[model samples]
Target chain A: MRVIVRTVSELCITAGTLIVLFVAYVLFWTGVKADNEMHDQIDQLQRQWSASATVHPTTKASATAAAPAKPAAYHYGKPFAIMYIPRFGFTWNKPVLEGTGTDVLKKGLAHYARTAQLGQVGNFAVAGHRRTYGDPFLDFPKLRKGDAIVLTDGTTWFTYRIDKGPYKTVPTDVEVIDPVPRKSGYTRPGRYLTLTTCDPEWGHSHRLIVWAHLDSTQPVETGRPKALRR
Target chain B: MYGWIWRHLPGNAWVRALLSLVLVLAVVYVLFQYVFPWAEPLLPFNDVTVDNQ
Candidate 1:
């Protein structure tokens, strides 16, 4: 009878260990799988957008003109495409939205505030979660200075490279669009991209900022690398 | 002792191994088949409308 108890105790310990290990394995894979699946979906959406982007004869002419060209209308599969530090493997399809909704933000896309119009010249920005639900933006910190960000309208793809920051977070305010950081001599009248995420993964005490200036634009179909004229 | 564990072990080890396999299979089936799909609705971003560009 004592031997029976000892055997049972040993069995219980072994079973418990196996169970714990199985659960850990499942959870870890769950997160990893979710992240991969999310990126896959975003990549698919991007490819579809690129395939269907409108190519206009107006492109070559616009490139020659001094005036800034406007982006095509917001479309799914057609939000601005960004290729970040490929080293960080940052790629996402940020669908332009007129407002932030659970529907819009879930697919690794940005939801524009309703009041904000799509593709407007001033401080056009979008937001996403730092964690959970295939949180692709979870590692915005991994981005470094001089990293590239590309936004496209099917016909023309704009490239921007990170300028500076790991800067202090600012409150959501109009000043974010002043065409320059206030009180700084950094003002320039050209296209730019501003990326934001929660300061720390779990906390929102501050916001992390990444800013980049227009590097160049290219025709997706033409596949020619046209450097942005500064 | 190690030799005894590997060669002289009782049928209980096999039984426990089988039981562990079954438990893992069942848990995985439930998780992938039902729990994940059910929990997907809890994600902040889900329905994305792609506008024609």
Candidate 2:
């Protein structure tokens, strides 16, 4: 009988230790892993940018060109741009990949494939994790209207100014990513940006959405946009 | 159970304790490197996308 009690207590201790280790894995280990992945994605994009001259960098002469150049097709699961939110922090930036798949997000922010490409006429939607995986959007609730979200495609800088959210909505509200999201208070189609992240910081039962409009576009030859100048 | 392992280890008490510590460290390394990563996506906290993705 005494041996049985001892065995049970030993088993309980082992199980308890494992549970604690698992929690540590979720909180600390994943962050370390994701931080490495995000950096790798950024490095890959920068390398490609330097190696390839196919992408036409917008210049002062081309800024007023008659027609906007069509962006190249986005390759799936590939990092294509770097996004910055000064509101998040001066050093806050993440690689924006092509799709929102589970595997894609582990690297960095994901661009919803169905939406408009960055700086295009329609909506450009992106999603990032709010809690785990380096907590990329952990400060999501701190986003406010009029904040600027900037992106660079290794060619042009697209500065989008927030107009509508940090709006809260359910995950099923697929319409939130519409070109002119109705809840976002836009009347007609325009160059827009939608940032979506899981709500509650620690859960995904709801989503936090933010809407922005393309405020300005300039060539990378020019310095960082005014919104990011500080 | 830990007690059973301790009893069966082919060493004196001090040596047995050292072996047990090594075993625990090995288990932790495996959990951190392989098991945790494989299990992360299966858990719910990483679910950040909409549309059940």
* Separate DockQ for every predicted complex: 0.10, 0.69
TM-score of each: 0.55, 0.92
- Residue A123, candidate 2: alpha-carbon lDDT: 91
User: Model 2, range A1-230, lDDT digits (tens) per residue?
Assistant: 99899988888998899899999988988889889999999999998987664554434346631224567999889999999999989999999999889889889999999999989899999999998889999999998889999999887789899998789888899899898899999989899999999888887789999999988888777778898887
Per-model TM-score (chain A alone): 0.62, 0.94
lDDT of 1 by residue, A1-230 (tens): 97677778878986786566545434454456555655665576567665664443444544532233554445543334433344345344443333445544544446344222222344445555565545646777877777766555445556667777545454454344355645222576555556655556655555666666667655555563443222
Best by DockQ: 2
What overall lDDT, based on C-alpha atoms, would model 2 receive against the true structure?
0.87
Which pairs of residues clash in candidate 1, taking residues 3 or more apart in a chain or in different chains? A76-B50, A76-B51, A103-B47, A106-B45, A106-B46, A216-A228
- What C-alpha lDDT values do all the predictions have? 0.51, 0.87
Q: How many pairs of residues collide in model 1?
A: 6
Native contact recovery (fnat) for each candidate is 0.03, 0.71
Best by lDDT: 2
Q: How far is each candidate from the true structure, as Cα RMSD in Å?
A: 8.3, 2.3
Instruction: Please state the interface RMSD for every predicted structure, separated by commas.
Output: 10.8, 1.4
